[model samples]
Target: MLRRRRKFLEEGYNCALCQDGVEETIEHLFFSCSTSSCRWLVLGIFWNDGGNIFDKLSTAKQAFPFPFFMEVVMIGPWCIWKERNALTFNGKAPNLATWKNDFKKEVRGHLCRIKSSLHDSINFWLDAL
Candidate 1:
């Protein structure tokens, strides 16, 4: 997280949706903040609400397993940045649900492509099945 924040800040940006102010906050980038079009209700703030969310994202396991967590941690920020660019460069502002769906699918696809596996061989086989 620290690593990512430094990198993004060096690159320059706030959260794409709100554009109010975002300082490399993982929760804001991935979960919180309302979109440009709609003024009510944030995108995925339901999953927000943690101080060191990047840390949580990096090492979470209650719901998503490690590989899935890593996928989100890695891809969520890129999605946000891409959305921001799309809006600024291409004049496209996607809906909240669209962003959320994209996030989920991206994470899932990333995990699949990375060929993530569970701890045990049997578990991996079962998951593959």
Candidate 2:
């Protein structure tokens, strides 16, 4: 449901987040866009322009513990999508602080659902951030 695909179906679709008039593909929105790139960089994840998000995740998975990586994979893009929606629908500008705060909030919330054994590891990772 990226703007690139939607553009094919309709017309005048552009990336809501960047507003750079680029066709918003899943890869572009979540991986390659400047906004997303900054987010990833802050997380210490540097994505190459070689492939899609999943491909990048596959490469990254080799570097990090799986559970922590999965948390990143889930929460990061969810924040990006929420930012996209905020801009697309509410005219709110993207805020990195807000994104970070939201990510922390989500990580904290997720802690309640996971096993207690992982709390220290997850909290350690979160603290490192």
Candidate 3:
């Protein structure tokens, strides 16, 4: 069984997203947490066995001709962090439906902001979704 940490809070620290009885550390938040793991699996569906998301993002400018990869890298962590904060501060629960809807909106917004024509990029994003 996972031992709960009681370092900072008056009560024990529980993961706001997964509630899997692990302390909320950076490692847990981004990779080990069940919630994050699920998100990563779903993201993998889009990325298609691209190793790590951060690895791909770091090479975006060199490997990818378009800015879509950068947008995905930027948005994925931001959305996860946002969800964590919402759960921590607002007592909100994890809702994949809302998360996915927001992701689509953010992706659409990012695609629209690209200055060049994105015919193929748009199709790629649509297919990925």
Candidate 4:
């Protein structure tokens, strides 16, 4: 993204993803991209069916309420990206099942710090389950 950002600026474009055609900005790609993964982030294609990106990001950045439901969501895409790289570079096929399991493991491994920052603690467990 850094390279793309630099290149985009050098090319006088506002966005690498949209080529300055729309409201192209990093925030848009991060929280508003229409790509499947980004849409998943905003629309909860699998993890966040109850709200949009604004609500989700606010919840993820929360320092109160003791609900870590957002942590799982936050950590999920890293695992997905790793799987994406493995498939892209290793010539292996995608495996949603294994990817999900690994995502859970990864989330659990780093989720302790975020455990206290949730809207409802129970919601975290529900999401993990």
Candidate 5:
């Protein structure tokens, strides 16, 4: 559950990721926060922040090759979630380089499950990063 929901259910919850005292909603945590915006920008995904998460994702999907986009969609939020948990529970700070490394490692590990024909293309994309 998000801090916003937790606030309603209990008391005194704030966004652990940004530390900006904003109520943490799914949208804020994954899309609207400055940290998340920077991550999306690094991925070359820009949006107007006018729509819901699904709408934003749909727009982003149109911008990248489907296979690569799918991999990013699967791993990106998970990286963010993991970082959030690390901060919330272990008092670790969020690190963009750590997130990038984790994302790359995860995508590489998943290559065995992807079609061999796309491996070259995916490897090229990963190399460019």
Candidate 6:
């Protein structure tokens, strides 16, 4: 991948978080990086067992608290990617605690925007957090 070639070009290539021996491929970035993996592990308590985030999300659609579940699935990686970009482009570091708090706030904001009855969903989401 082009991203893996950044090192050959003298551009940034290694992961911003771990700086381990591997190139920053999508798989390593999203699934294998120490930082991202830790984040995913935290969220995994709520996620159904599957191969990865997308796989778990696809299987989660049938479960109740649909909106809450969907928001977590959609937003968790989004926030991680946003932080990854910040670190890549701005030399910023990943903040796991901040990311977790921000994720909760994002989920709550999304739930508020929807009109569905969320009594059970809210309780579930809060318990997961």
lDDT of each: 0.50, 0.76, 0.62, 0.49, 0.75, 0.66
lDDT-better candidate, 4 vs 5: 5
lDDT score for candidate 5 against the true structure: 0.75
Residues 1-129, model 6: lDDT tens digits: 344345434644666667776788876776667888787767753345447767655665555434555555667778788887766656566898877887777766677565568756665765676
lDDT of 3 at 92: 66
The TM-scores, one per candidate, come to 0.46, 0.79, 0.62, 0.44, 0.81, 0.64
lDDT of 5 by residue, 13-99 (tens): 667777787888888888888887777666666655788777887888887654668677777788888888877666677888787
Regions more than 4 Å wrong, model 5: 1-11, 65-67
> Which pairs clash (backbone N, Cα, C closer than 3 Å) in model 3?
none
Highest lDDT scorer: 2
Could you give the candidate ranking by lDDT, starting with the highest? 2, 5, 6, 3, 1, 4
Query: Residues 1-129, candidate 1, lDDT per residue (tens digit)?
Result: 455445445557666457566654645555566553231122211243564766554334354433434444466567666776666556566566666666656655554465545334323422342
- Residue 41, model 4: Cα distance from true site in angstroms: 9.8
Model 6 lDDT-worst window of ten: 1-10
Give residue 94's lDDT in candidate 6 (0 to 100).
80
User: Candidate 1 — worst ten consecutive residues by lDDT sum?
Assistant: 37-46
Using TM-score as the measure, name the better of candidate 1 and candidate 5: 5
What CA root-mean-square deviation does each model show from the true structure? Answer: 9.6, 4.9, 6.3, 8.2, 4.6, 5.6
lDDT of predicted model 2: 0.76
Question: Whose TM-score is higher: candidate 3's or candidate 6's?
Answer: 6
- 46 in model 5: Cα distance from truth in Å? 2.7
For candidate 2, report its TM-score: 0.79
lDDT tens digits by residue: candidate 3, 25-60: 766777667787676555552332355656544544
For candidate 6, give the lDDT of residue 47.
41
- Highest-TM-score candidate: 5
Show the lowest summed lDDT stretch of 10 residues, model 5: 3-12
Per-residue alpha-carbon lDDT of candidate 4 for residues 1-129, written as tens digits (9 for 90 to 100): 455445545665333333335454534444454432443443243323347767656655562333454565567556655654454345445565666567657765674565445435534553654
